[model samples]
Target: MPDSLDPSLPRIFLSAGELACPERPSIITTVLGSCVSLCLWDRVRCAGGMNHYALPYPFTADEEPNARYGAWAIEGLYECLLEQGSRPAHLEAKLFGGAALIPAPQAQLDIGGRNVALGLSELRRLGVPLKARRTGGQHGLLLHFRTDTAEVLLRRAGG
Candidate 1:
């Protein structure tokens, strides 16, 4: 599919019971693994959006939804920001995801680390400043945000 044909450019959708905002100031929430969820907020405009992506790029024919990839998911978030009238130079970000959810001692690959690093790098490339972040752990997260108030609620699984 062409870049413009990507599914992330449209309005919000529900996947795995999570909300993904692809336009305007919309509240979205979800859980993730090595995958990352990025929250983009335009404080001056009092608007924000979020995206939950399984992989950095489109999954291969044999792969399942790997929400941990930064490539595909980040692109979706960017498209949403643009659609919301966010000026690339005027945007700010809050990042989450990349949990080392596997039990320690058996934890090997640092998927969370990669996700966080890529997320930060992408934000910088887009000229958005990363204002806050919570990443790397052995637990899942339930995220909530209200675009009107620019408030984010983070609930850890079973907590």
Candidate 2:
């Protein structure tokens, strides 16, 4: 229920612009820096889903949001979970990643910050309650989400 990682569990790694809600229990995992990932758990179904996004907002707001941007990522992930039998009212969230990894100008860090901010705002707008978080630092993170129990183990990884 906390920070345990079982070696025997099946694991799935999500690349940027991807979202997943496995039919079976899995150790859904991903690595991130300057990007953001949302760990969404459905209480009624006892299932969970995850998403990884590079930017908080899309290039064009009206181009139909998908998993590539945070706005669409949140939308797509929720839609996927709903299609898989989860109720919007029974959902809770855990947020991860959004690190200032690159050594570019302030623009790079600003992007990371924007990712976190937008994620929080979007979830709020959609009425999803955020339960936990391990985001916004100068290093990357490795996330292991236990789909069966809807628990997560987050390790501060690279910088």
Candidate 3:
């Protein structure tokens, strides 16, 4: 059996503040509620990555460079994969997150909804195919990406 963390087939764990990939097929995982995560894959090359971002920004502008946001998160993930030799044309996306956990009366603001919209728009601007998505609900999600097969598994909290 191969080691789970094998570089050629690594098991990457992406938290709210991280992203990762592998030279070969790998597994990338993250947790989210209102925040959104976009998983990018190059079907031809079998190379891809994933990102988890909180809001669109920590602040409107003048925010710290490391601030976690959809724009920066998507750019970073795209660059990382490209640097690894994945082409943009071959890129496909799987988007997840944006949950309205609070009751409707209190969940009016809907930052989660905003996150989902921003994520989709960003991906579209980059010309990536929006293959599938699971957004807008009252529950959190646990996502797992299988880079080898380009498979995504989403498990809803308490369901």
Candidate 4:
């Protein structure tokens, strides 16, 4: 529904390992391929945020946790929305990405599946109701999220 984002609003491209939660309205976009993005919005406060992560978990115990991992990204996005005056109970979530773009053998780990699983579990843990989702397939996706309305427009990447 975000036709072109108000030309005046800031438009941001969310790269993997990045998160954005602005106090004002903006348009946030990202591309996904086996990566996952957790989009959050608080209806009561009219605040929204998004995060992109490439891996399901941190690689090491000593690794500085950040938005690059599912756990950290979810937590960060939630906290960011909270800081914007949104109540925890009012948060609604939308999940996307985690496509198995490349073929994987039966025994091989499905990174896309794991990423989706982690995102769902984390949202449940935070008590955020999942309102929408478009995930899991062989093709990549391009996502555009409107922070003011929490509306998302998705298209298959390269389609």
Which candidate leads in lDDT? 4
Residue-by-residue lDDT tens digits, candidate 4, 36-114: 9999998987779899999989878999988889989999999888877889999999999999987888624788889
Off by over 4 Å in 1: 1-19, 22-26, 57-68, 104-108
lDDT of 3 by residue, 1-159 (tens): 223323465577787756665676788878889888888998888778888888876665777654268878888888889999888999999999999877566544788888898888888799999999999889999887887667777788667
Candidate 1: tens digits of C-alpha lDDT, residues 50-152: 7665544444756543343566567666676677676777678888877877755543356666677888888878888888788878787876655544566
- Candidate 1 TM-score, C-alpha based: 0.72
TM-score of each: 0.72, 0.88, 0.87, 0.95
Model 4 C-alpha lDDT versus the unseen true structure? 0.90
- Top-TM-score candidate index: 4
Candidate 3: segments with Cα more than 4 A from true spot: 1-9, 104-108
Instruction: Estimate the Cα RMSD of every predicted model relative to the unseen true structure.
Output: 8.6, 2.5, 3.5, 1.4
Q: How many residue pairs clash in each candidate?
A: 12, 0, 0, 0
Between candidates 2 and 4, name the one with more favorable TM-score.
4
Q: After best superposition, candidate 3 residue 35: deviation in angstroms?
A: 1.3
